[model samples]
Target: MKKITIGICSIGSGVGQSVVDSCKFFREKVSLIGLGNNPLAYGAFDCDKYAIIPSYYDDQYIIEIEKIIKKHEIQILIPGHDDEALLLAKNHEKLTNIGVKVLSSPYELVLICRHKSTYAENFHEAANYFVKTYKAIDIKDEFFPLIAKPEQGFASKGIEIITTRDDLEKIEFEPGYIYQEIAVPRGQDPSYNAFIKQLRKGNNLQVSEISLQLLFDRNSDLVEHCATYNTLKGGVPIEIQPYTTTELSGFIKAITSSLKRLKAFGPINIQGRITDHGFKAFEINPRFTGITGLRAKLGFNEVEFCIFTLIYSIKIKKLKLSNKYLGIRQVASKKVLQSRVISIKKEDSVQKNILLTGSTGMIGSYLLKQLSDQGHSVSRLYTQEKELIDNKKGYSITDLKSGKINLSNFDTIVHLGFARPNSTDSEIHSSIVNSFELATQAAQSAVDQFIFISSQSVYGFTSNGKFTEDCKTNPQNNYARAKVTVEDHIKSITKLSNETRFTVLRLASVIAPFDSNLSHEAYSSMIVSLLKNKTITLSTPNRLISKIDFHDAVDAIDHFTNYSSSSVYEVVNIAPNKNFSLLETMKTVAQELGKTEDMILTESIENEEPNNLVISAEKAEQQYDWKSKTSLNKTAKYFKKHLGY
Candidate 1:
């Protein structure tokens, strides 16, 4: 069977959410389209497709609804609010002409139900069950302890309880107010009396209430009815149970007969409280109520029955009701990360907001300074509590993972934090997991560009010649394996996002001997040995190594931050134009430090195969128009100047 396309309006309201929830059961038989005035409506997020339209009171509301219905090819439209229901009922012919069926009662019936005075005057069959109501202008002093309600309102808004003459005199007589007798008599029920006594003592308590839901077919024949006794907390039903008594059954039978006489169709909800005078209805809603979805849990779904009978022309003989469980309502929450609205600006706009992780580390520290010097707004991310650097505030990684941090304000995120090779197994594991989590959050938050500082060690120590970014990874150590894991995870997670661009930079060994913040084992070991001992030994002196200047690595990252492309995921190797042997690199450093060649010695270990590490940066050069400019000799000179040897 072809799925019915149904559209629901006013999705920001409680009834709208309930209708959406009820429709979920027949998802295979229908396609749902949610329409809301607010952008963050919960029901909007739950639908297959949704659109924001004008308010029901707006002049363009009907036109917008028509457009949306035609766009989505909607065959049925359900009104979610009383006012919306009345408006749609008034334009029944206009909507029907466009091949759409509106699930609503007649306009006259809706208007009578909306106005309390009108309902009391027209609903003669249920006169004994309805509380005596009067116009606000005709209320007298004898009508003390009466409840004043808005003539046209739902959800119990604008209700005032006038218990004394003084209370009545002090209230302003609004134009659209109706006065009705309170359902609970002054001293009749002990439960109501006790509740009143506690309320007088400044303690609020829940009120016992009941609701009778009636469903009718297109021909005004009563199809099903459900009676529920519930408790209200702050005008909302918190606990409810299927309830029926000898007296209540009689009341329902009379009301159903009266509604059928009046040609009532679709869903109708009557709300009241049981008093000594019997069940007194204070209000009647001519459409679905907020508990409609809750009713589905008991297998008495009025929505499904109405759709099948009215829209599909299929008769529903009976509804299967469940009394095995009670329905409890609680507060539920959903997190919605709206897409960031970026202002239109020139391409060369300065002052980009950047978030930097591992801000105190070697590459991060240098990158932070460079970005700040370029007039970019930079925020540092710290794993633990630390002192402020340059009076800049630090954000916690915990906050990012927990969604406490709003990443929409940032244009770029540079993640350089990682555990060193010497770290414990647990620490390394934590770092790897945190890195993936950060990437996932970044993608979900819709950050513009996410640059992950990966290591070329992911290629391992097996390649003897130069390798490009397309080479397969062969990790030889736990650290290299962790880097590959992060790379793969970032690519997979970011592929789902259209707003975030993920760039993975696999950097070669970075040489920054002049900076004390450097802690990598390879460069640190070589420098420490050359400075402390007159003779330095190398096991694999001829082993080739690919290294990039610290400034060049930082520059490469800056290049990608400003780069834009159609590709959402990218991986680029960052290395120098030339590769050198370990012996040649140490010799250059010794020469720069004014040491003779005799100070450096080479030794070969027996039965050991030489392994070389080399990577090509042709992708970065071709795509980013960038290359490593600083040579090894220039880096060595900086070391000599700092060491004063």
Candidate 2:
């Protein structure tokens, strides 16, 4: 099936975001193009393609939209703001002429709905339920404790409550402002009074605010309607539940009649309170509301129904709604990085001054050589005076501990120094102390970035499912515990500083061909057993393990050090996409060395199941575009050549 291309305007507004959320339900059938005046609009990152266009008030707004429509071959355009909707409604002919359907009401009806006083006057069937509106100049003492609002606004902006004549005299009256009786009268109902009192005290409590949505077909006949009792904070619904009342049913019928009289079609939203006299409507929006997405989750998907009915001419007979669950809302964020204009053709394309610890360690030695060869200025941090004698750019660990090293001189810090897995308690404690001090100083100096190399053992090596970065840490040993402690400390110290970015790369077991300086303990031991004994044995042959190539580990460090643009703070796993069991790995080694499978042996335990230590590198791929390129079979070949097998 061909996907329908849809365009959304005012992508930063709540309504625009709601429409974007609704489109996800039909993602396989539709393509979204987000349009906004600001490039940094939140919806820009959510859509398939985004374009910055002129504001709705601009003369070139329609022309720009038309160009985008022709370029992307858009079939439908949905307006996200009230003012923008009205503008689109006025230019409905221009859009429809270009083979695009504008999802909005007629221009005449939108005008009445956009203006507060006009809406109140035109909806005569619900006239008795409309809040009494008074002009600022015509206000009297009897209208005390009235709510003043802008004649044209959304999200409760420019609104105030006037409790006394003195309060009214203190402010200047604007031309486009209207005063109305408070929707909820004081002392009317205990629950309503309590809600208002808490609101006055600025408490975040769930209070009732009823909203109704009416869907109309192409013929301007109301076909379906639903209502939600909502609780709002900062003009956004935080919680919603299905609600119905005798007064609400009558109000919906009356408003349906009013909408038919005014020839309003498509989606219309009505908001008000259940007051002493019944349901009084204070606001009417001619387009979808923020809760439209929430309604879709509850199975009352008006957006889908309207599109099928208006565009495809499909008739939807029954309105299905599920009220068994409550809807809750929370804020979500997405990071947008500035695009890089310069192509990184070589490792030296973008140079950064780096301060590196653990210069003699397995991964650190390779990383140090790579950084220096790439033309980056590298300064090594040594734990002993003897290690610093030959290098002029080297500083002792005492220099770091005593504040003798000026950390601000370096743009980035990579800490890979740690005690070995079998180290004593005191040695591990000392190592942790040094790392904490370094992180504290780095944050204090406002370094641009800090990269810490941790281990996958922090996940506790469970036997079950694969572990993503979000899995809870269950450090089972001293080494894993120390890593978690240091990770927490680094995150805490860097939390308040926006200038410093801290990244924790939880690395899996590293494997490579045998080399005195480069070989890791596990890989070296395996190679030695295979060469000397001409056979290998495993107690738990089915145990799954995660390993990365040595060169790939070095590349990951380099990528995060310079190329990652928007990672303020993150913790991601560094592992290969493939998984291999202990027995399979040994067999691959034997095959590379011209040995048969009979040379491999396993002692299976009676009831012991094999444990898994598989790590997920999905976040690294998605966030930094980093992945392992070297295969395990290739590493086995390298081992064959290194050992002369």
Candidate 3:
């Protein structure tokens, strides 16, 4: 089984602990990364690996989380507390950009559940079994012996019994404070009279409250519900049993159906008491209950079910219930090692706003997708008048030479649109004019940097063994000359404008899927032909080529864009160090596709083959600490699945 990293925030909380405990059962398949604001949170130590993060209210909270997600490559992030859950749900778009799946209720539903007053106002009828609830300000002619608690209070915190109107008057009525009619608990059906007698005599003050744990999917459809007869100790469920009554179960099902309209997801806990009249609900917690671990140990595992269903798209079979299933909770402690306390500080990193050109081009398109996935705000610049559909936010510059493009909102302008083949002298001049104009506009505007994508062709054909960034440029063709001209233009802009920095990246041949604007490359072409059951014929079998994967190309751009440097200008070469000959690459692709080397027609191959040019990225690695990490084995496997080879 493939292992995936899963992060649980506020893991010290009850809900987070439950999730961590459940993840332990799937240790073979899941790597749990626990996070908490407090060092004392037990879940932090209980998880496979733990870290102490700032509170959700902290300004650096999301930034730290993004760093952790990137470092650990966390695929799913589960918020354990109500506030964190709501926060994660609110910033779903931001987190999902990094491929992190957040399982949480909708923001609206979270609001309804976080405050008792809101839940009572919006869902009173559907939850009629609940205690008679009223806002403190709206408690007009209500009877005495009312229960008052904070509207957004968790557990039994901030609860007070109001026996007289004078008592209510003496207490300040804050917006978050609400009043409710108390419903005395009654015993089970057969022992109801005896329990009431004992309660009246003060001999027994037991409040028989049962907690109903409900599970829902992303679509807000209820998957299952478990009824636990809870024995509370200081507002915490201590002893629990899988107990259910027909009347109580019916009421819970109705409530679940009503909540489904809110698109509420994950586990929801409904706490209520059994009274002489009937089962009366007190409040609803739109999250995993405190008894989740106990319940999982007994029969059902909601965390596992939810993860499997949501992440893997696997359907879970209905869990078999057992009334005899029982579990107990006790105070358990683990001696903490003082050295394990990890203190986290905010790193010095700023968010970037990128203006990317040639978004419709092959490389640019991939770069745009990758940037967006990494939570960077990138705006696409188009030269033609294209309708912006699917809510793509960008600007269209019909005339780039006019210099009407807006560079005010962007911090970096990346130019990848200058390369145009089969153009006349006039068209070439127009492209050059447009490229220079755009660079000038960027340098003059508030933009901090201008990144020009140049080609390694600027080096011409290197006579030496390898070409480095320090090598003098010797343009051999129109395309190479055009790239060099743009590079020089950008350098001149940097000299004139002291505020803006300039960077030039001379990229080698990239091995990636060719889009409509891109030409078929040797690597991808060989793979595609193999998938189509076609043979490849090469006149020269020993033509060497140095190629970088498309992903690594994106990595190079990301590194420089995010690199905070004091230098005014820098030029770097970007390419893989490994080199492969045409025949060797063809045989590898064929082997990966389970085809024989005979599939490649090498009969016409000449004994002598041309040597390939080489470029080194040592400057990029030393200056920006950037290196391309691509394996031919992995790339081949990716192409097999990506192109159905």
**Model 3 has how many clashing residue pairs?**
2
In model 3, residue pairs whose N, Cα or C atoms come closer than 3 Å (at least 3 residues apart or on different chains), thus clashing, are: 97-373, 129-281
Model 3 over residues 445-486: C-alpha lDDT tens digits? Answer: 746667888888788774246788767898876877888888
In angstroms, give how far residue 352 of model 3 lies from its true place.
46
Query: Between which residue pairs do clashes occur in model 1?
Result: none
lDDT of 2 by residue, 198-268 (tens): 54653323356788889887777888888888877766789988876456888787888888887887899
For model 2, the run of ten residues with the poorest summed lDDT: 336-345
Compared with the true structure, model 1 gives a TM-score of 0.53
Worst 10 residues of 3 by lDDT: 199-208
TM-score of each: 0.53, 0.53, 0.51
How do the residues 524-597 of candidate 1 rate in per-residue lDDT, one tens digit apiece? 45754566556778778888878888889889887776565323567899999988888888888777666777
Which TM-score value belongs to model 2?
A: 0.53
Off by over 4 Å in 2: 185-191, 195-207, 315-319, 336-645
The number of clashing residue pairs in model 2 is: 0
lDDT scores in order: 0.77, 0.78, 0.72
Better of 2 and 3 by TM-score: 2
